[model samples]
Target: MAEVLVLYYSRHGGTRKMARLIARGIESTGAVATLRTVPELVVAGETATPQQADDPFVTLDDLKNCDGLAFGSPVRFGNMAAPLKHFIDSTSKEWLAGTLIGKPALVFTSGSMLHGGQETTLQSMMLPLLHHGMVIVGLPHSEPALHSTQGGGSPYGPSHITSESRRQPDNDEKDLAIAGGKRLAMIAAKLQER
Candidate 1:
């Protein structure tokens, strides 16, 4: 089966929830979704073990092998959180090897407020994927939820407005996320056939 890696770094569970919803969308298209999370970055000389949480730590192999990618992160000051960035920065080897070239990829984020830089954060996450030559997948205006969402949905990607709270995403947000995943899967499958 074609496999799409749903990789993320979530704190306070909002982004993690988004990742699951996206994975559901991916699987609805009959593609296998491999969900993985990265460990929190530790300071040098610190002996901290990474937390597994709902998903295990992601390895480079996951990036190299996946047919598609859906990346998620909590927005931090108009950017992805350091943990996810740290992980992406470590993928120079993958970039050099061209392992992710031509794969379809999407990005998602959760922010504490409605104006909390959701679009910018999603764009920031796409940078490394673009460098790796992955095709960035985004929601089009045709997605109905994008027209009426009071919470979060964007042309850039699916998003959630957490208000910095732990509440679950609204229905509109969920629908957009699922749609984005399914779209990514369909595009990936088509590309893989080329």
Candidate 2:
């Protein structure tokens, strides 16, 4: 079956909630949404070991195999979280292989404050995908949530403002995320026809 990989890293679970909403949107379009996340960073002098988390950690093979991607992260000083960036940096092999070329991709983020770099974080995630030659997708104004969301929906992608580690998505944020996912899946399905 065709699959759209919904991959992200969440420190406080806020981004994870958004990931789920996006996955719902993807599946609503009859495309598989494969939700995955990156492993946590090893602390200073800590031996690196495997983790058994709620969602399986992402592998390069998953990227190579996915038809589309919804990449996300929690904002960290106006950038994507370190774990997600670390994984993206490791995808050099996939980039060299052109594994992600032409895949439809989107980005998302969650942050503490209204202007805590959510949009920039989303854009930051897009740079790597663009380098890999993936087609970038984003939330459109046509999504009514974009117009109404006072918290964190952007034309760059869907986002949520935690205000202080709140993990739940408000109505407009949920609507925008789902809309973004549906749009990405629909685009992926169209690309598959070509």
Candidate 3:
């Protein structure tokens, strides 16, 4: 099966939940999805050693081996969170080797408010992957949820708006995520066929 790496850094579990649902969508398309997370990065306190969370920490090898990628993060001032950024910055060797070139990619994010920079966070994640020469994947208007989602679904990628009163994504958001994952997996599988 084609393997797609699903990587993310989530603080309040919103991004993590979206990642899981996306992975499910990938699997539904007969592709394998490897879920991975980054370590917490803090500047002031005792710097904690890197450790695995519920999902194992991603390695350069994951990038080299995966047929596709799904990168997600929480919004930090309309950008990707620092922990995820740190990990991406460390992939210089991989980038130099063109490890991810021609691979398919998807990006996702979660925001605390309805208007909270989710698209920008997704774009921030896409920038590095674009430099790595990955073909970015996106949701299409054909997806019914995209036309009507009020929580968080975008043509750029799947997103969740965890507003002040909400944590879990609504049905529309979840469906979009799954559709995006499925679309990514299908594209990856098609590419592998060549």
Candidate 4:
């Protein structure tokens, strides 16, 4: 079956929550949503591996095989979290092979503050996908929440802010993430139809 990969990295679980909501939106459209998480970064000097409490790690092959993608990350100074960027950086082989060419893609991010670079982080996530020739997708103004939301969704993508970390998505933000995923899947299906 064709699948939309909802891939992300979350240290405080905020991004992971967004990923789940997006996955729900993808599956609501009858498209399979494959949720995948990346492992914690291992430093060069670290002898011991960090054990992830939960969340399975993703492989490059997973990204290569997906029909569409919903990439998410926590914002780090107006940029995507390092682990997610590290994964994107490693996709050079796929870029060279044109493995992602024409695949529909979208991005989402969580920030600590209202202006915590969420849009910038989302844009940063888009750069590699653009370089790989994947078609970019984003939330449209047609979504009612986009007009009414006092928090998070943008034409660039969806985002969230939590009171504790300032990066968790509020209810509206979660809805926007799902809407973005649904739109991406619909677009992917349309591309396939064409």
Candidate 5:
């Protein structure tokens, strides 16, 4: 089966949760979604710590081989988390090869406050993928939740803004994430079949 890579970096688990929901949506389209997380970067001579057992690190080959992509991260001051940035920075080889060219892609993010830069973070994540010549797929206004939700859905992409003190994805946000994933997968599948 074709696989869509659901790649993310989540420090407090909120972004991870979003990744899972997107993966579910991808699978619902009958395309496989491979969940991969980046390991925390430890500087040389700094203490190396293990990431959570379940959140295994992503390798560059995973990025190169996936049929499509769904990237998620926690908002870090109006941007994606540093760890995810670091991972993307290491993908120059793929960029040079144009390995991701024409692939379908989607972005998702989790933020602490309703205005905590969710849209900006989603846009920020798109920059690198755009540079790779990947085609971006975002939430369309056709999704009723995008119009009705008071929080966290954007035409740029799906997003989650945490209202509670603890950052977590709400139901509407998850629905948007999944919807975005499904949209991406459907586009990719059609392109592949063509």
Candidate 6:
């Protein structure tokens, strides 16, 4: 079976929840979704500890082996969190190897407020994937949730608005996430067939 890597960094469980939902969507299409998270970057002189409660830290091998990728992060001032950016910055070897070239990739994010840079964070995550020559997959308007979602759903990718509280994603957000994941898997499968 083809594998889709669902990589993310979650500070307060919002992004993590989105990642699992996306993985479920990926699996619904019969694709294996390998979920991974990056380690937290500790400040100098600070004690380094595992930030992720249980998810394995992502490795270069995950990037090389997966047929597709779904990157998720909590919005940090209109951008992806530091840990995910740090992890991607370390992928020079993979870039040189062209491991991700032509692979289908998508991005997702969660933020504290409705206007809190969710779309920009998604776009920011796509920059690295584009540099690696991967094809970008986005949620299209055809998804009904995109038209009806009052919480979070965008043409760039699925997103969640976690204003004031880290509430569970609303039904519209969930459906859009599932649709994006399924769309990514279907595209990956088609690419593999060619």
TM-score of each: 0.95, 0.94, 0.96, 0.92, 0.93, 0.96
- Tell me the tens digit of each residue's lDDT in model 3 across 34-89: 99999998778677676548899898888889999999999999999999999999
- Report the C-alpha lDDT of model 2 over 96-164, residue by residue, as the tens digit: 899999999989999989988988898899999999999999877788888888899989999999965
Using lDDT as the measure, name the better of candidate 1 and candidate 6: 1
Q: What tens digits encode model 4's per-residue C-alpha lDDT throughout 90-194?
A: 888888999889999989877667787888999999998899999999888888788877777789998877566355566778789889988998988888776
Model 3: residues >4 Å from true position, as ranges? 45-52
- lDDT, candidate 6, 63-158, per-residue tens: 988999999999999999999999999999999999999999989999889998999999999999999999999998889999998888899999
Q: Clashes per prediction?
A: 2, 0, 0, 3, 0, 0
Q: Cα deviation of 36 in candidate 1 (Å)?
A: 0.4
The C-alpha stretches of model 6 lying farther than 4 A from their native spots are 44-46, 164-166
Deviation (Å) of 180 in candidate 4: 0.7
> Which regions of candidate 2 fall more than 4 Å away from where they truly are?
45-52, 164-166
Candidate 4, residue 114: CA error in Å?
A: 0.4
Q: How much is 141 displaced in model 6, in angstroms?
A: 0.4
Which residue pairs in candidate 4 have backbone atoms (N, alpha carbon, C) closer than 3 angstroms, thus clashing? 111-167, 112-166, 162-168
Predicted structure 3: lDDT: 0.93
Q: Over all chains combined, what TM-score does candidate 2 have? A: 0.94
The Cα local distance difference test for each model comes to 0.93, 0.91, 0.93, 0.85, 0.87, 0.92
Per-residue lDDT of model 5, residues 27-122, tens digit only: 999999999998887878999876664656788889877989999988999998888999999999999999999999999988778888988999
Pairs clashing within candidate 6: none
Supply the global lDDT for candidate 1.
Answer: 0.93
Model 5 spans with C-alpha error above 4 angstroms: 43-47, 163-168
